[model samples]
Target chain A: MNGVHDLGGMHGMGPIDPEANEPVFHNEWERRVFAVTIATFGGGNYHVDQFRHAIERMGAANYLSTSYYEHWLHMVETLMIETGAISRDELNAEQTKLAKEAS
Target chain B: MAVLTADMVAGLASTGASCRLDETVAPKFSVGDHVVVRNINPTGHTRLPRYVRGKRGIVDRDHGVFIFPDTNAHSEGEKPQHVYSVRFTPRELWGGDASERDSVYIDMWDDYIDPAS
Candidate 1:
């Protein structure tokens, strides 16, 4: 499982840029996403390694463009689908409903 | 230390066979044995990091039995095995002109390593 996530000891990624005045979280959404993902994962939907492996399964492009919490949210959805906690269609429909309600 | 109630640990630390060994398990190799990590590209979860794959190292010490992560991740069973602290020189891993003063030590299971021939 040598995915792009295992960037240890690799070269040419360039220096890490520590953001100035970065908050604990960028937004409320991220906070909720983190808490929900942790709670779901704690409920034994999947092993810790399994969750990490799922995150590593993402394509390089998707992994690169997404923020830290976005990777987590995607995994939450994936684990939900995989464990039969929820179906893809159901999650998608719920997403649509939420988007409409928010608008 | 103050005692903690059951509710405090609800659903926490409820899983995984413990990895500690109360009695010594026979080791395949002792300290200073030259070995090489097997090159394996597994489709499932593994504790063997990618950087050390197929690289030669010396057995620094035996860490004794531990739950094999490769199998535990898939619920395939703990399959606890002897894990060794193998120290790899930067030169062996990164080829020429790396760091002469630097080396990397990895805790590797029996299945992931073999005698360096």
Candidate 2:
């Protein structure tokens, strides 16, 4: 439970650099990812805290390095697999298919 | 049973049924009461942040009853109980160099605290 997400009273994370004129999202994919995550959670498979726990379950190294919405994307994928919503193979196949289609 | 319908999702998105104040089960600590957070290390999910555990604080405000997250996240039960905002002096938690003029107030459930002797 003691993951990077609980960075409350800790020190020495470096200064938080705020972006000037930052867009609502840095890119479009993040918006889609956010929508999917919200929709998945809305599906009633899990509660908000459960989603947070899944996010917290990420390895400390990966959790700390990834961007904010990247964490959301990873956790949503995790919940999808965990709840039998989608299997690992299916997710991989879909991603691969999407990548090919994108190219 | 399956995924929530669009209407249901819309309904679920707006409100929650977690906060419920039960009159029969009274709050043990009241506002201005001094209490110490029980240093518990539960294996599952908990709302009690890691930093605030085992720290002493004053009951600043009664937030009223709400679902206890410790149980709620684990599929145990709602376990609705009175929640109080505990104000901790920065010095009490973070030690020297912490500003004495400022404090951190964390919302704590009744189950998480005990009367400080």
Candidate 3:
């Protein structure tokens, strides 16, 4: 896999930091889980079956500007909230608390 | 406040089936076939990356076919699409100045392709 730094000049963008950083969480298992989610949903061409015919319907900007892991994170967060694995309030509360702690 | 019921927990767990690894299915396209990755952005949900839409790719490898849910965004409301391995050369995707040998491999659904030649 190409490191983020390898992307220099392709999109007219500069090289990103090449350092290998640790994951945000201390739990290796949690990091692994996040890696697994990113492994499948993180890259490439993907689609919804029933909505297959509507692919050409998406906006250009949304189609070419999002990151692979960002997409996966978005999907997972949506599922988590939708299925009650976590609630909107809980998510907000946790995020707020984390942000405050980091400050 | 009441405790969460087992049924409720199961309901959330049963949200839908997940993709399983498959080794026997043949892919629909081969390297060099011009194809487009589907562009799907639902207000509710989607797995397709925003950066790949409309951009063309060449079939890089046949990672074999697998069952991918219609729109994991739709709460299991649709069928799955046949997935394939496609590669995009960096120069082709990002234009000149991109590394000549750099290519990205991405799994795409069959519906995302059409004849390029």
Chain A vs. true chain A, TM-score per model, equals 0.89, 0.90, 0.44
What is model 2's DockQ versus the real complex? 0.51
Model 1 agreement with the true structure over B6-104: per-residue lDDT tens digits:
553464547532456565567788899999899999977777788889899999999888777788767798776799899988898888898857988
For residues A1-103, write the lDDT of model 1, one tens digit per residue.
7777877677888889999998999899999998777667655577676677778887778997899999999889887898787899998899999999999
Candidate 2 residue runs with Cα over 4 Å from true position: B1-24
lDDT of each: 0.81, 0.83, 0.53
* Interface RMSD for candidates 1 onward, in order: 7.6, 2.1, 14.0
Best by TM-score: 2
Candidate ranking under lDDT, highest first, comes to 2, 1, 3
Per-residue lDDT tens digits of candidate 2, residues B21-68? 564567888899999999987767777788988898999998887877
Which is better, 2 or 3, measured by TM-score? 2
- Separately for all candidates shown, the number of backbone clashes (residues 3 or more apart, or on different chains) is 0, 0, 6
Better of 1 and 2 by lDDT: 2
User: What ranking emerges by DockQ with the best candidate at the front?
Assistant: 2, 1, 3
Q: Which is superior by TM-score, 1 or 3?
A: 1
Write candidate 3's Cα lDDT for B19-44 as tens digits: 64544555567766788765554453
List the candidate 3 regions with Cα displacement exceeding 4 Å: A1-24, A27-81, A84-103, B1-18, B21-27, B38-41
Q: Worst lDDT window (10 residues) for model 2 chain B?
A: B16-25
